[model samples]
Target chain A: MTAAVRRRAGLRELGLGLALPFVLVVIWEAAGRAGVVPQGILPAPSLVAAAWRDWAFADPGLGLNPYLGTWGETVLFSARRVFTGFVCAILIGVPMGIMIGWNRMVAGAVDPLIQSLRPIPITAWLPFAIAVFGIRDAGAVFLIALGAFFPIVVNATAGARDVPRNLIRAARMMGANERQLLLRVVLPAALPNIFTGMRLGLGIAWTAVIVAEIVAVKSGLGYVLWDAYYVGRMDVVIADMVSIGIAGFLSDRVLVAVQLRVLHWKQAVRA
Target chain B: MTDAVAIRGLRKVFEGRAGAVEALAAIDMTLAEGEFACILGPSGCGKSTLLNVIAGFEAPTEGSASVFGAPVSAPGPDRAVVFQEASLFPWLSVRDNVTFGPRMLGRPKDETDALARRFLDLVGLSGFEHHLPDQLSGGMKQRVGIARCLILNPRVYLMDEPFGALDAQTRMQMQELLTHVWDQARGTVLFITHDIDEAIFLADTVYVMTARPGRMRSRIAIELPRPRSIDLLTDPRFNALRADILRQIREEAIKAMAEEERARR
Candidate 1:
């Protein structure tokens, strides 16, 4: 397509993206009003929006409503777990991946063990997490960390392994020591792939947090999701779901933003 | 000083999946200080193998290499290589790639920047300092690669067909740029290529090698005047050298083809 036609399509995409969500909301509100859909089963978007507004702004009245004016606190709780878990994942995972990738001895000793353990789901570790940490912040953190770690470690290993042999040779020719090659060449070269892994890992961390919060732990958006469901406040449950999505999206956006900044060199290749 | 690089009876063998194959055999060569020498031969003649061995990226099975009277054991700053591909870190800007060595060696940032800028200008990459490898054309990326090696101020440069991947026009242009850069900082360069015109145009001497399990066939000194030009390609002396080398290579190809046919039979 010509540039003008391509741009026109882009504008259409923007319009459609905005319109689609609005259309969904309108259909939902109509269904709720017409009673075509059972209100107890599926709350209208308008009702959920109102509940979210109240939960974010209106008084709690001694926590009677549970969610009232505490939406920010709940979001903060989940966000903190994800952020801490992701940071821990990166701190441990990236170096571990580098070692696993660069050293045959490390790869031989650790790779099989990691590969064997990787297929075991993070949810399976929940009971162990709860048992070990006893239904606290650490338990949720552990679950999130474990969930995020696999993608980060695996991607880091692949990235480090896939480092162009010629670049390493070039560095070696230029008299770079082993440490210099790892820190300067392998790490930076692996970063683009690592960022891809980070984004995927962050998404899993969000899911793990919700799972942990709903079962082994309390407090956070996931706890509120379950709590509101138990009390027959379907509106709050729907609101909580949207809140979780927005939280996850915003957190992923933060990672993408960070990726863009760090990979500025890769970006420069375009222009 | 002794020759910038001296290799005597150098040999290399590779353990291929099929079997052990000799890459280079009984190779003997010397590159004097400030001379541009090209090792030109057919593919798999081990021209690149020789370059790699001299750069210490690979170990020779026999014999040894010495640089400036020092026994060469491993790659050091004094010997920088320009691979066939630029191999500039795709994730680093042209400027950063050029300055990587100095920075890692703990030279202060200002010093590194100044050195990088000088080399960038020297290699005609002054305007492309901030661009990434992917942003540049094949020729431009190779220029950055040259600038990177130039920045190191290495005593010897081992360039393996640095411009071989460029288009015809771009390849000629790179040849000119290389000559220009070589003029600025005269270092012993062991450039490897299969192109006769390229070898003649760039080198003060061209060493022709016989095919696989390669050995030095002959070394011809090009008396082509310095500050050379594209016009020299048509000169009788140039064509004479090209024809001689072409005949040698053609005979090698025919002989190798006959051997292959026999093996197939």
Candidate 2:
């Protein structure tokens, strides 16, 4: 296809995606304005948008609004927590997974412990986290990393385990030493699976961050969400919810984009 | 000169839930340097098991397999394999796959690059250097598999039905391509295939294997002239060889089936 035609098609797809959300917003606004829906219970989309605008752009010196000019800081705080936690999870999880999958002794020693710990929900660990780290960022980071670790490790293990037998044999026959076999053959073979784990772990990281902010720490979008709701600032609560959704969605998209690029050979084959 | 490959009393048994199943039984074979030998058998005849033992992918339950005077203990660059599935690394480009052996051995880039180019040309995949294995057709993938193994300059080629998965037309074309390549760079080859015509067309000698607890049932030396082509397929001698192999395989297959029936009963 020509570049122009491809561009037009892409624009059409964007329009199609926006159409439903646009309609939902319009209907919501109409309902709120007509009082068909109570204002206190469910604020209009426009109210939420206006509240988000004030939160993002208003001057903090106004002293009347705590949320004013703090949107960026809160977003950054939550993002940083998620990023650090996710990185920690990856650092521990990928190698642990490879070892577990590749070596029976490692699997025997580590797999049972992981399986036992995985059943405990991140929320259940909130008290333990707060008690251990005393409501600091470390507690939140610990919770987030712990929550994300399971999927990353599990997926990485599965990926490593599933490297084709022939590929290993072929690599060996081609004169790859033990290190080369693992690094060049098994690791690359397991990459697609590792990416899958990362995506799942990232989703869990977002969840862990919100939970940590709500109970263990007193900052970020999750803290603001609970704080806004308690004060009956429903508009800010809705805005915060939207902000979290956007953040999570965008982070997931970034991961998927990276995955696509890294696994281009896989996609090329399918095409 | 030392034999390119030597096997003596090689046997393979797999311990399964049911029982110990003998895959190969007292198999003995040898390949001289630069000779193309094919092992023809029915399905489940353990032809691949023999090849795997020779390739050092599997060890025999008894006896020994050695390549070029060295006892085969592990797979190495000295004995390259072309698998039935054309198991080229999916993540690598065709060029990368073909050059993988030399690159792993830390050969100079200029030398390996030249080798890769030459073999790629020989395999009729010159423009497909950048393409991944997945993007190529079955025939093309097998060609890449051949080139990859050939690039190693191994003492022996262990092919386990490398063209078995291709369609008949593609298989014929691959057979022709293989023979053409073999004529230029002849090595010791232990090719395993079920197709009688394929065995007769490609090998200097054809070893017919028995079904289940596979053993060397018969060995027939092909007297066909070298520099063979597809036109030789119609020759009377080719058909006579085919008939002989067919009769032997049919008897073994029937024996295998009867054994299965007895076990079921």
**What do the candidate models score in CA lDDT, each in turn?**
0.89, 0.92
lDDT for each residue of candidate 2 in B176-223, tens digit (9 for 90 to 100): 999999999898899999999999999999999998999999899999
What TM-score does the predicted chain A of each candidate obtain versus native chain A? 0.95, 0.94
* Index of the highest-DockQ prediction: 2
DockQ of each: 0.71, 0.74
TM-score of chain B of each: 0.97, 0.98
Model 2 misplaced regions, further than 4 Å = A1-20, A35-41, A62-64
Worst 10-residue lDDT window, candidate 1 chain A: A262-271
Tens digit per residue, CA lDDT, model 2, A1-271: 8999999999999999999999999999999999999878789998988889989999889567777989999999999999999999999999899888888899999999999999999899999998899989999999989988999999889988988999999999999998888888888888998999999999999999999999988899999999999988899999999899999999999999999998998889554
Give the TM-score (vs. native) of candidate 2. Answer: 0.95
